[model samples]
Target chain A: AQSVSQHNHHVILSEAASLELGCNYSYGGTVNLFWYVQYPGQHLQLLLKYFSGDPLVKGIKGFEAEFIKSKFSFNLRKPSVQWSDTAEYFCAVTPSAGKSTFGDGTTLTVKP
Target chain B: GAGVSQSPSNKVTEKGKDVELRCDPISGHTALYWYRQRLGQGLEFLIYFQGNSAPDKSGLPSDRFSAERTGESVSTLTIQRTQQEDSAVYLCASSAEQGTKNIQYFGAGTRLSVL
Candidate 1:
């Protein structure tokens, strides 16, 4: 069975600070990666996804992720974050079988 | 008509009771999945149904938890004997098919509270 691991449980940053959330998976075959965010009182929304082609994928709300096959990692990044960016972020992966696996999630708090 | 819909937005049941959560996938979607999300936790895959295939039940937590999907439409997740630990949000999502590129549409989810 494939599994996903998130390096951070909670992250606190000031406004305009750069952000990077690590995500790693344990799949040996080709995989699809995704980043989803859940704002307070909101449903989980897709941030970005890596299916194939380019290793760097950009998503909504100025978020992006780079897929590194050799490292088995797809980390989410933001050059600068705003207070409105505070939310819970989740990294998910789907193996060739189409079964999706999600990491534990990381709670990001951006202070003004 | 826009996205997946789940009924009984919130359910409160006592321990040892049975609870049934319903999920209505997007129109024409051939694949539906059930997932559990405990408080402050990530989604835990439960079951996946594609058209009429046997259904991938590898993620079901236990025998007490079973789900059934009629054709390619409505799906029901039943907990035979609920426990306090079963308190969580049951989320339902639908995709076009079993592929890596298909984007999944998720419902608001049914919050289950076992007291």
Candidate 2:
């Protein structure tokens, strides 16, 4: 069984502040990583995904995540966040195209 | 339709009653998934269907929870004798095929409240 962990439960930041949310997973084999965001009442939407190749994967809405195999981590980051970026973010992991296991999620609150 | 669709966007049921949740995947999609999102909890995998093959029910919490998918189209998740603990947002998602790289588009979800 694969497990994902998100260190930050809630994050509060001012507009234009840099952001980083830590995510770690326990899976030795090949895995696909994803970051999904749920704004207020909207459905969960993909932020970015990593299948292979470059460790740094850029996603929608100026968000990016870096996959570090050795560290077993794929952390989401954004240079500057806006008020619109306030939402709940989730990190999901799938081993070899199987079902995904998601982290508890991190709630981001960007104050304007 | 354009994306995965879940019926009864909000369901209020009594404890000990059975409730069925429906999911209609996007046209032509071969893979569909059901997940539960409890308040402040992560998305919990429930069941997954890939074409006409047997569904992967490994993620189902207990025997009381079961799901069925008709071919590659609609799916129904049934909770027998629902309990208060079963209350949560049941989400449905679908992808192009069975692969990790494929993107899964999610529906707004069916919020089930057992009171």
Candidate 3:
């Protein structure tokens, strides 16, 4: 079985402030990691994903995440966040494809 | 539509009643999944199908929860004798690949409210 843990429950930041959200997963086999975001009253959409190659992966809206294999972590980062970035983020781990286990999610509130 | 679609964006029902939520996957997507999201909570896996066959259903909370897919396209999640605990947003996602990593496109989700 696989599981995901998000270190933070809620995060607040001012516009242009740097941001980082921590995620860790536990799985015995090959791992694929993903980050999804849900804006206020919007559907959940893909942020980024990491499967192989470079540990650093970038996604839409200037968001990025680094896959640290040794740490069992895929943390999302943004150098400068905007008010529109306010949303809830979820981290998921898939041992294969299709089926995934998700974390509890972290709510991000970016103040303008 | 270009993305996954869930019918009846919002549904309200009385406790002990029955409700059915529908999901229409992408045109050719072979992998479909169901998840539950409560207020201020993350998505909880419920079930998944690969080509109309359910291979993973360990996430279903209990016997009251059941789901099925047909023609490798549409899927329906049925809750028998719904409880207040069943009140949540039921999300559906679809992916094209079966074994490799692929982006799972999500639907707007059906909000199930039990009164």
On lDDT, the leading prediction is: 2
Candidate 3 residue pairs that clash? none
User: Considering TM-score, which of the candidate structures 2 and 3 is the better prediction for this target?
Assistant: 2
> By TM-score, how accurate is candidate 1?
0.96
lDDT of 3 at A15: 100
TM-score: model 1, chain A: 0.98
Q: Pick the candidate with the highest DockQ.
A: 2
What's the TM-score of each model vs. the native? 0.96, 0.98, 0.96
CAPRI-style docking class of model 3 based on DockQ? medium
**A1-112, model 2: which lDDT tens digit per residue?**
7899999999999999999999999999999999999999998989999999999999988999999999999999999999999999999998995678999999999999
Interface RMSD of each candidate, angstroms, one decimal: 1.2, 1.2, 2.0
Tens-digit lDDT track of model 1 for A5-105: 99999999999999999999999998889998889877677888999999999998899999999999999999999999999999999988768999999
Q: Over all chains combined, what TM-score does candidate 2 have?
A: 0.98
In candidate 2 chain B, where is summed lDDT lowest over 10 consecutive residues? B95-104
Cα lDDT tens digits for candidate 3, A1-112:
7789999999999999999999999886788999999999988899999989999999999999999888899999999999999999999998863468899999999999
* CA displacement after TM-score superposition, residue B89 of candidate 3 (Å): 0.7
Q: Write the candidate numbers in order of decreasing lDDT.
A: 2, 1, 3
lDDT of each: 0.92, 0.94, 0.92
True contacts kept of each: 0.59, 0.90, 0.78
TM-score of chain B of each: 0.97, 0.97, 0.95
The parts of candidate 1 lying over 4 Å away from their true place are none
lDDT of 1: 0.92
